[model samples]
Target: MRLSRPLRALVVVDGTDLHHDLLGASSALRDIVLEGGVVADRAVGADRFVDPLPVTAEADVYVLYRSSTHLAPEQQAALSAAVAAGKGLVVLHSSNLFGFEEGGIDADQVAYELVGSRYVSHGDAGSEGTYTVRVRGGHPVTAHMADFVIEDEYYVIECRDDVTVLADRTTPEGGTQPIVYVREHGEGRVVYVALGHDMRAWGSPHFRQVVRQAVLWAGGVGLDAVASWSTRFPLGNGRFIGPDGGAPA
Candidate 1:
C-alpha cells in the first residue's frame, strides 16, 4: 500500500550558537514542507541530543541546522550511518560551521564530507546587504525557483568539486559564491543551502519554496512529479493531495 504521509524529516538545531532561533527555524521548515511530516529536535551541546538522534526509525531526511563547531563522535557516526543507509541529508546555513574550525578540520568531518561545503565566514550579521541569488540550472530543487533578492547574511563557502551547483550569489567583490548545491553520497542524497541567516529568510516566500522543493528532492521525490500532482489536484493552497483527493495524514 502507498504511504499515507509523503515522508518523515528530522530538523536538528543542535548548536545554533544562539545566533538564530532554533525553534523558530525548525517550525518554519515544518510549515514549508508540510507534505512531508517533520520533527524538530535540539542538542544541548556537542554531546547531548534533546531528541536522541534516532537510530532504527530514522526519518527519510535529516536536516542539520546547528551552528556548533563540533558534534559528539557518536552523533556524527549515527548521521554517517543514516546516510549510508540511503537516507537524505540536508545541511542549512550555520551547519556548515560544523567543521573547518579555528585551527583546522577539527570537527565533524563526516558531516563536512556529506555536506560538501565549509563555512568560511559571512559579510555581516545584520540586514545590511542584499543578496541577488540566482538558480544555476534546471535541477529538481531549483526547477520552479527564479532569481531573488534577500536581505540576509551572505556566506562565503569553500565548496567541493563534484557537487552539482544549484544556485549562486555574486558578491560585491566580483566573486561568485555558491548559495545552494546537491550531490549524491553513498546511496543517499545531500543538499546544502547557505541562505538562512535568520527570520528574514525563513519568512520569505521564495526561500520557503526553495526549501520545500529541496526537502522533497532530498527525500528522493521529484518536483516535476509534485508539480504534476498539484496541477491535477488544484488545491490553490500549495499543499499535497493524495490521488484519492484527500490530504495525507
Candidate 2:
C-alpha cells in the first residue's frame, strides 16, 4: 500500500549547535524502509533534512534535533508550518526546549499531553537513577527493546485534553513518566519521544521502531500497520494452554 499524497517524510537531525556527528542519525534513518519496501522519498529524507522552510509542507516524518535554544522563532515556525502542511512530525528530547523555557506554564501550551501527564524535567542521576526500558506489551516500537538503562533527563509531560500516551517509565518518586506520546496538530499528526539526548539513543532499534511507526501512522496508515520489523504486534498473550496450563510459544 502506498502513502497518500502530502505524506512524505523528512528527517532533520539539527545537531549544528551540539557538535556531534549527524552522519549516524542520517545513515540509520536512511536505512529504514516502509513495509519492507524502499522508496525514493524516505531513503533520501536525511539529505533533504534542512534547517528551515526550503521544506515544503509537512513531511510524513520530521525528526528535529534538540538543542539549547528555547523554541526559537524559526524552529516554532517550521514546526507549526509542518503541521499546517498536514504531515506527521516526531520531536526528540531537548526539542521540547523550544516550547518551554525557565518559566511557568502558559496559555499557548507547548509541553505535549498525550495520555494524562506532563513531561516536565529530566531525572537526576544521583537520586533518580537509571533503569531498563520494559515493554508493556507487543508494541512494534517497544517489544524489540531489551530493558536497557540510561540516566537521561526524564520529563513531566502534561497530559493534554487530547492525545494518547504510548509508553511510560517510572521516576524516583515511583510515579509514571510519559516517555512516548502522540497527538494531532490540525489535520496532521505529531508524536514525541521524551529521550534521545544524543546519537547513541537515536540509533536504538526500539527508538527507530517508534519513529517508523509514527511516520506510517501520521501518513494515514491504519491500525493494521506494518513496518519492516513489525509483522507481529498488539502482542497480547491471548491464548489458552493445551489440556494442561502450559505456555504457548
The prediction achieving the highest TM-score against the true structure is: 1
Task: Give the Cα lDDT of each candidate.
Answer: 0.68, 0.50
**Candidate 2: tens digits of C-alpha lDDT, residues 76-148:** 5455655646756666664554334554334124333211233455555342344555444454334333444
lDDT of 1 by residue, 1-249 (tens): 122355777666766546777777777666665533333333334342223446324568776677677666677676676677788888888887755555366556776687787888775443347868877646777764557788778788888787998889877778788988999888888989988877888876667666766777788876556454322112245443323334443
Give me the runs in candidate 1 sitting further than 4 Å from their true place.
Answer: 1-5, 35-56, 100-103, 123-128, 229-235, 238-249
Among all windows of ten consecutive residues in candidate 2, which has the lowest summed lDDT?
232-241
Per-prediction CA RMSD (Å): 5.7, 7.0
TM-score of each: 0.80, 0.64
**Candidate 2 residue-wise lDDT at 107:** 18
